[model samples]
Target: MPIRLASRSLPLLLGLLLALPTSLHAQQPTAVIAAEASLESWYDPLEALGTLRADESVTLSATVTDTIAELNFHDGESVEAGQLLVRLSDNEAQADLRAAQALRDERRNTVNRLAQLQSRNLAPRGDLEDAQAQLRQAEAEIQALEARLSDYRIHAPFAGQVGFRDVSVGALVSPGTELVTLDKLDVMKLDFTLPELALGQLEPGLPLTATSAAYPDTRFEGEIDSIGTRVDPVTRSVTVRALLDNTEDRLRPGMLISVVVNRAPRQTLVIPEAALIPEGHRQFVLTLDPADEHRVTRREIRIGARREGEVEVLDGLNEGQLVVAHGTERVRDGQPTRLLGILDETTSVPELLRRGRDEAEASG
Candidate 1:
């Protein structure tokens, strides 16, 4: 009986030992992460989705009705201005030109003969005038035929890269038929739309920056070339165009890109997103006192636009003030916090907040 009683007590003792540590740990305070503030320039960039397009684009088409005799340019070939791209059946044009020349030659011979006769007083004045008129008419006909012959050969209108050829050799095409597409891509155009509120800030020649998903690390700079005079009633946005040098031709048309337009520069404060704590509809953060390294105070911040893991604090924060970065949720107002190593604390809050607010207001 004594052995059985001891076994039952042993099981109960083990259970109590397991539960005690959990309860004790639950009651203990958790370590909170903290950050120190420093003054540095911060940018609250306005971001928008855009597409890359060629500065000059056109579709090549035939100017006259004819059957294609030869296709000079291959698909996706770079061509120069005035380069021959297509050849049409010129046999008929050549024959017509020859006929016109023959008629002109006969008329010229008659005019010469009549002029000599009139000089000798052997021909009537009316006859000489008729011969001269006939010569002039023949010359005009020849010039017209020559112009028609020139149309049989199609030339490039501008220096650009050619797209796929639409017509093949021996294909019959008319004036309106598409032959190929030509695009000048040495310079590219980036087009994006901005909110109507930004219309006041937007102007031609404003500096802008852009990035593409294909080359995210690389940044391209440009300036606003034009702004839409009228805003779209449905979207309430205005179109903006920026011209960028794409000499390398790395950027292609229709590629999606992100645009950032800098309107003006001002000073503001900025912070990281991890430092913010949201309670209900309001936002707050844990701020540390410079005098006391451990004492933290809950600061209610008027937040603005957020991007790239960072947040802009419009109010309730100041430059050079330490703010808790990590472990914000565990921190309470006036709680003592352990200062971990400051991670990227070198940023101004005021300038960041102002820029963020401007962008948000523009978007709204």
Candidate 2:
């Protein structure tokens, strides 16, 4: 009888031990970082990979085949519009131009003499008319020669930086031979592609931000300059072009960039992402009871767009309500809690705990 009684009491003892921990845990307040759900502007982001390009870019080449006579620009030199960059051998063209000028002068003298003689009835009207025609032809010939001479020279079409010079003085070059590259760098054009599904939201003037691996810490800001006229049938995407100010000249052509386009802003309840508790497909958070600040209630919530360290709470939460941002694993529904410092984007769980310990010692 004594052995049987001991066995029954052993089970009771185990049960009591388990019950004691629950009672103690319920009374002991758990310390956790808390945050308030507040109303803030929220944006939906569309992301894509982009390629950077100069606002204006072109490859300079010779218009006619000739030998390079003069190189006025060095590699990577900045030049202004209409500035002479190269002068090919134009000796033959110059000679022709001089001859045309002399012929024009002679024709002009002949026309004047004939006009004077015709006015006094000493020359025929046909002779004066013929001289006038010859003078006009000579002038036209001079214009044609000047135009041909222009083909032997190269000028900067716009103000920009020039790339490497491909030829040197006395080097033979032909038509379509690349002389250099010119790019306007004061503004940058970012071209990216987005899916056709995003076409409705895409338009000119939409704000965006971009980042490059080369400059990881820098964020480039710009606005949409235009949208593509047609969607690409193969990719089911449309091209987007944005203009970013490059006054500092930090951006370059062909740099790979990651882009984020922000949609219209709307007011929504936002909370630190640390406060969320994920269970399968649903989400939950521990909220402090209004009547009992120490007590917590596990509430289910729906979430929307998330960015950085914060998340948008779509349902089951109200603005200005307090939720446990940290130590959710240590607390249970209806369990008592001790408030620590509120968690923010810049604050960490360990930092908040350190502050709590300091405050407790001060108060004691």
Q: Among these predicted structures, which one has the highest lDDT?
A: 2
RMSD of 1: 12.0
Ten-residue segment with the worst summed lDDT in candidate 1? 35-44
User: Compared with the true structure, what per-residue lDDT tens digits does model 2 show for residues 247-275?
Assistant: 98888999999999987758999999988
Instruction: Give per-residue CA lDDT, model 1, range 177-197, as digits (tens).
Output: 888889999999998999998
TM-score of candidate 1 versus the correct structure, residues matched by position: 0.64
Candidate 1: Cα lDDT at 312: 66
What TM-score quantifies how close candidate 2 is to the native fold?
A: 0.81
How well does each candidate superpose onto the true structure, as a TM-score? 0.64, 0.81
* Model 2 pairs whose backbones collide: none
